[model samples]
Target chain A: MDFSQTAERISLKFSQKGQSVDTKKIEAKLRRLIEEFGVQPAEAERSVTNELAKEFNLPGIGTGGGGAGKPGERENRSIADVTPGEWVTIEGKVVAILSPVSPSIAQSGIIADTTGAIRFVVWAKANAPEMRQDAWYRIESAVIDEFKGVANLKIHSGTSVKPIVEDRALIPSILKVGELKPGIGSVRVKVVQEWETTHERMLQSGIVGDESGTVKFVIWKEPGKERLKVGAVYTIFYALVDEFNARLSLNLSTATYMQDEGDITVSGGDSNVRGAVVHIAPGSGLIKRCPVEGCNRALSRQNYCPVHEIQPGFVYDLRIKGWLDDGEKTYNILLQREVVESLTGINLNAAKELAENNPLGMDEVFLRMRDTILGRYIICRGREIDNRLLVRTCERVKMDTGEHTALLNRAGGAP
Target chain B: MSNGGTPAQGRKEGGFEREPARRVFAGELRECRHQFREGDDEKSPTFVLLPTGERSNRVFLVGTLTEKQRKGEQNIFYRGRVVDPTGTFFVMAGSYQPEAMQQLAKIETPAFVGVVGKPNLYQTPDGAYLVSVRVESVTIVDRETRDLWMLDTARATLDRIDAMAQGLTPDAARVKEHYPALDPAMFRKMVYEALAQIKI
Candidate 1:
């Protein structure tokens, strides 16, 4: 390709600053870099301009590379094909905008095309116009860099970002909960559990699932947004997926909801967690529940329920409210009477006898239960609801000597 | 379960998530020499920086309770030594942990036990820091349970060692700044030795 036009653009940039120009020398350098070394035309222009700027004692000038060529001159590459340390242009929709972690980063988020999605960052020095989330943009001359073993685009002052208005929709195809990564997608899920609104900003948050798996979802309070009821199925469009502690969840801040007919057979909420009973919280062991038909609330110290009036004749129950730690994560487990009785070998009648015989009264039963189960390694199978596991079955974990031996062999081989 | 009233009313009021308890071997646990708080508030959670570059607010361990002694005349307290496969862990339970103290007082010596508690760093007069577990809860366990704990702890330690070797996450990077002389191989060796104690 001819280098005169490109060289003239470089000379005009320096002349705009009232600096002396060397058009012939610039053209020769660009020709050598492109033809001999086979550097990308855009990269070659940047290198040559940077060289000229230093020769003229200019530090930051020519770094933008705006005078390189027209927008259509550079090749447009897919997100998946771009590699680190190369200058390439990519056209993708802004999938998600993550809050910037540093002052130097003006914007940082994931951008995706039909091929795949990749993280992108716009440096404060780039001075590029802010790209709205879910909008399409054609970013030119953006450098690729790697962080945490993942390649991402780095938009600096040399890059040019122009928003695009595509006639076709860039929305990704529907995905199952198990197939979700950190991006934007659509999914049809059943609202399995509804949790109390913990914050004013949260309209609702709960676990949603389908046959594939279950995932936590949060709906921020917004105008004209419909709340999802438990046991109802809905198809969510354009929901942003986020990950924390290696677990994925959905954020429906900028998403659309459609109530779907019928129900889904959910599968993923059931978990089998094995760990020590680190804590046997209070209100465990022998307790009384309000006898008023539908009101099963645990009675207070004086046999009074918050919602129901004083009930002198309350029904007795057994349960264990505790925390279990499986090394990596802790689970809040609620063990019902049957599971607690099987594990502790203390039935409801036996617990009532202990409470009546001891001067400590009901507190004695709690003490006895704590002595029987605290710090024990037990496996519990149950459905997780609002971060707490409602255990259906539980038993002490048996040591697998063969497993330990194999683990030892593998660990010994590790470098 | 009926929801007329929620379980753990006190925990509901706070509405904050609990910090997970990490499983670390006593050998590696003793090597932790740094402690930090995430914020300036007194209520901020304190974390013990593990040698493998992770932080633990609470730790779960199972070992053999070798001995025990009760101290403090006015306010009774209990101190015990628990021996795991790799090394010994000192546990203390005072009035603050009445349940643990009571449990410790009743348990006999040389019995298998499980403990979950926070790590407290005590600086000696000579300027060296010593680590011990402030007992949260203690219970009797079987040899099989202790062996299982050893296996789980070994796996967790190896995972941390690998993460530190990669040095990818911010936790690993921050750990490098504090423990500059830290070596992943040493922790790997510790894991191997700990696992070797559990015989099939």
Candidate 2:
């Protein structure tokens, strides 16, 4: 609403360098950029400052103490306002400190304000003082740069860091399991399952779920971190989201969690797998099940159930126990009667009829079913439990000739 | 009946982990002349280095069974020529693979068949190496299955070619060293040609 305050701030930056400034002219430019042209206040300020620097023949305007401006005179810009290639001051809490991959990067982590959060890197050459985690710092003259379309700050030699006191806490917004990508976020989920710890470095690993869906989570062995109890709800903060085998999982190595009072009603989400039915297990096709109400276990050739003993009046069912190989990994898939009947066009009644007429009995149905489905490429969708996909639906994968043709054409091959 | 009851685990015989069967076209399968084992031990898995920089221990292929011949009176080996769009893959089913041998013996000629097996390279006295599949399982498939396999193999071949073109990883370097005159364009052409056979 008022341009004189913004104009005075800009004039003070130049005045600190002993340059003669025009407050009226700076106010007019800010009014034109913000009111007439509809530019964001911070961006407009930067554009007008760059223009004034060029006009006054002062290229070193915002380069901290090295420049004409004093070290702490520059106003701190909102983290959301900073754009790439501009030098601005930002005051935000250090929410996360990630392990730097390269030696040239002395520290790399996430900084957050109430507006938004962004990645920041302190270069080794900057020789800046270490900023404590969870503490607010006013970073002056930090250069903004972009990597992979996301904006981040690059603290170099010219940047000055100072600890500041702030009352309000800046907490990142919580994200649902379905909305997660490969990044950092907070989530509230109940521990659905705790799987066996596969490695010595793994403190705990399990499936966590919320109202939206479930996701696998792993917490590496870290000091002062507690294990998560199954079926207990918790709000996890600053968890690193990682992707493996195209599936997203939360890595809680550097995260903190708090037990929540309420519970989450999780949805048994479905996943899809596409591959060839490489192998069919022996207990497939027409099988005799125990007639007992709660016991439908497959009966042996002698019409005996393992738990319920011998059962003469056995119910017939058609199913396919097989492995689906998607080139990289193998999924143990259990295709129930409905899915098997839909895929092979052999219903339970037809399987029973085939077994009754043949001298080989149930083996005939197994052989026929294997011939119908094995080596065929299919896509199955269902919920995965204990590393097995309980296939709800199965369909043969039709070749999309047009897509392949386009792909080949793009690869510079004759199509 | 108890709902959500766990199904029986269909563990393969001997309980050994099965190798992932890589999909490769008949043309690419025929060109896999370099075969090497991972270790010197007899039990070490052997892999055939594909020209597109993939080392495949087992391959799943679907093609038309063009011809079949029953050889050796005592051993009774069944050798079949399976033809896809690009080329023919020779498959052999011996006594050790009785089920595959039986299936191959009974299958009619010119029928679409799917074969999952390991590629074996044998050197003749004249020093010419011939690649053939030691059939693990053979089943009668339909035209749609064969067409789908072609598309899948095309995608897989293109992925390997793309990986090889991107950079020389250890596997890609091994492929380059084995096939000194390897040209990714040739595999790309093969994939295109394989896909062209299938109608929309």
Candidate 3:
């Protein structure tokens, strides 16, 4: 057959097997195989068709295992050894059970054996037995299939799933950093870093760890309230692991909490930052705050704080939302009332007077503050919360004329 | 149970760690309208998922300051138009945005500038969305900086395109699911053509 006829036949076979293959990809792969191997056209066609059939687990194709076993009752294969189009009886524990949400699909989740883990799928029409999580089940006549390059088991009506009690000790616990998945996970580690706070909200973020290593963590309470002191050992429960720029950060919500296991020094993690003030964001000017003690909430347009709710005694406050670029990474730096006042030398009283004088005068004050701070290199000491630097203290980096000239040159300009 | 490993910093619940700004053309930014929150919680970070599959909260762009105007009779804010080879970006800095507004006020039009800011989306009366930048910081840079930003942004855009090709990111998969007809090669060509505009 010609190439187009061969492609047509392969597409037809895949459709009959209830699988959708990228016809273009198959045609390209077939062309590459023919060109590279220099095999006869008819032989290449048969090989491509057979391979695609096996990948989709269609019946009547050879198991391709090359093992001497019975036609239907084959010896158990390891999780990794289970190939597409092969049927085998395997004993393994279901690691996780995922509820299939689509109307067309049924149940699916991850199942692992001694060798490795693979996803298992049972179609809605298959009417297969339920696979309980963390329980060992001996699955007979389960066909292996490939989905997106990963080998998976397809439990059809022909498959039999029998529960077998196994020792729970064989299951893994307390995921290491390497074993961390993007779902509920627990880690036991010393508090390597204590609470870092952002002034915009009473939020805390820091690092937690054990020898398998540490990961970033964020809790939505003040450090004092969370009692997350540095160098303390705690078992952090129910952390939602999230990937930021390929690095994992744990989010501790109401469902998540930590148990203190006393003091233990965790070496090597600190967040002392210094960088040039590259940008100052809006909300960096005169602002009103919630009157309630310890509630430094920025009032909404309705003049209400979520916690305090339209109190008559709201006070004026100062804050700055700025960016600091330290050559490598840019940090969102938030300076609270005191830091803003000290850095710009604009007290709250002066800010109020400026606002009272003219409607647009407060804009001018913020403009002046921006002029004073932007582009200047400064050292900042604080903890990071919510991916922003919560500055406790800061000072400008004094640049000599020579240093100034060097900076200007690097910026591609002359002084 | 605590497992030990290297210590990494944590990010806040509602806030995301600020992503590095991506240099992009006006056309690409204008075309991006889909915005979604990453998590269901109140603190979940919202991101503007681009057609090229990049999820960004902040973008770094360098362009020519083509025009400037004062908007809002009651509020009195500054709006500047910055353009690259593809299109223009409207950067708005109000009284609240003191630094960006002052920089826009002092700088002359038709001069090169670098702006780092958050992407702001507004829906108009005609049911179409308008894209603009809430300027965080705007600086009057030279032509060289403009060229460097273009190259960097093009490289970043290409990275996203490559990711789509490899099917490595969920954003890429979502792009395919949402915009089935989008030709990724078109974005790749757009980046290369954008890079070609630079003399060096």
Candidate 4:
């Protein structure tokens, strides 16, 4: 599990329980818990999670086995065994106390057992006891409903909420490659390779592998931070997965944390190809950028940059993304501003002039430019970056103008 | 899928990929009956199948601008009709399409023009769909450019046919699925017919 993501989720859980806890402070505490106190990362996570819940008087989440109940009073159930339309007595720790879905709702969030986690909702009008984060709960007479295919518990006037204590740890299950999805997940992997940054916000990217297989990962970290050393094993916490053509790549953010778990070797390589330009993706024309120093972020919707905040000083830029096909296979290629301007003969200033003269005309000009080279052949050099060729060098293969002219003349022309 | 098989993540919202503007005939554009969605994401691409069975998000064609008109009382919009050898293609430009709209406003009718644009498939409540080109670019080109476009489009269409025969492209699979009646031979005939229309 990406620890940073776990920390973030934990902090969010505490905040939703109406606790005043600083996220940065939590992150710092988590780091110290693992490094100084020598607590296992998962155990450290539980401690911080439990400690905050105690201070805020929040329900225990991820704490195992709770609530007082009599035998045969209600059908006992585990989280993973839940199905639609089942009314059963379930016991689990409150992993997260989510914000009420609406103002009229009292409390709702995820409750987890060793089997799995499911969402629970206690409607406000029920006037049920409030649940706290990380607190164990044994609720009786809760009904199950399938919402969008996921089973969740519904607590109402007939339901009873009880806070009970248990002493088992809530550890994020180590996931495999096939188990990865487009959401938060944690994985243990060997750093097979690491690449230098080529794109913004992507501090470092390369390959990571485990027993199942390998996947690409891009670490989003502050510049100059210590990167995960190649040839080492690390437990990544709170990582986000993004899929491309069925392939997955992991994204690391600030809320995530990593722990070095010694060293292991892994292997992989890159492939290269060349082809003709087939398509030009949209956003191929004039665009604006944030003008802050070292922060040329794309400005959209109110002209804002997340990092530098809102700075109206904008700059013009150009880019083109398209495919290159050499008959057999096709490769996605990216042409940055310089290459685009060089190929299209349309510079930022020229595009700006066109935009000024005819704002919507820019799209037409863009398509016209795409036509000029779409069928032409070209040679581009770059390795694959998420199934796309990050073209480091590009040169157009000049077309045989003589033969094309002859063919056009013979095809049909006005007398 | 509408965008052939372009990956979903790479073409996120706000990003654009120029679909290989298939060289579709005006008649085929009008006769196209099915639309395929590549991805279900909010920004996923939607493509229409020409009568010849090739999928197109964008199209490149050369034609004669037969007429131009500005419509709308509160908002001025530019709409034109371009006639190819086989049939007529309706092209529309509005505030959102300022560039094409302005160009249409300036162009004289009966002039040879080249257009590259997204295929706009409009479906009525009655289940009838109208196919048109959302103008991306409109340029007044000479007859030579028209002939060149014809030959290029013919070659590209032939390539698509060959790819389909070999079962090499994802588009070929979609064509086979949605347009089972279409064959390379039929598309080949259309390409030849289009080329024959170009008088030297």
Query: Which candidate ranks first by lDDT, i.e. highest?
Result: 1
Interface RMSD of each: 7.0, 8.3, 10.7, 7.8
- What DockQ class does candidate 4 belong to? incorrect
Question: How many clashes does the backbone of model 4 have?
Answer: 34
lDDT of 1 at A157: 77
Q: Give the poorly placed runs of model 1, Cα more than 4 Å off.
A: A1-267, B1-15
**Better DockQ candidate (2, 3):** 2
DockQ of each: 0.31, 0.20, 0.06, 0.16
lDDT (0 to 1) per candidate: 0.79, 0.78, 0.66, 0.66
Output the better candidate (1/2) by lDDT.
1
Instruction: After the best TM-score superposition of candidate 1, give how far the Cα of residue A15 lies from its true spot, in angstroms.
Output: 34
Q: Provide the lDDT at A121 for model 1.
A: 89
Residues B1-200 of candidate 4: C-alpha lDDT, one tens digit per residue: 11223323335454454445566667567867678788777767788865544566777777899999999988988888998766789888888878678878988888988776778778889998788788876777667656655665555555555545555565555566666765456555655566666665
lDDT of 1 by residue, A268-329 (tens): 45688888788999999999988986456788889987656699999999999999877656
Using alpha carbons, what is the TM-score of model 3? 0.44
RMSD to true structure for each model, in Å: 13.4, 16.4, 15.8, 15.3
lDDT of 3 by residue, B156-182 (tens): 565566655666555665676666777
Per-residue accuracy of model 2 over B66-185 as CA lDDT, tens digit each: 999999988899999998888899999999999899989999998999898999888789987788999988899988888777767777777766666666334765776789976778
Taking chain B only, the TM-score of every model is: 0.89, 0.88, 0.86, 0.81
Model 3, A331-390: lDDT tens per residue?
888888888888878888998888888768667677767766764557787755435676
Q: Tell me how candidate 2 scores on lDDT.
A: 0.78
Query: Which candidate's DockQ is highest?
Result: 1
Order the candidate numbers by TM-score, best to worst.
1, 2, 4, 3
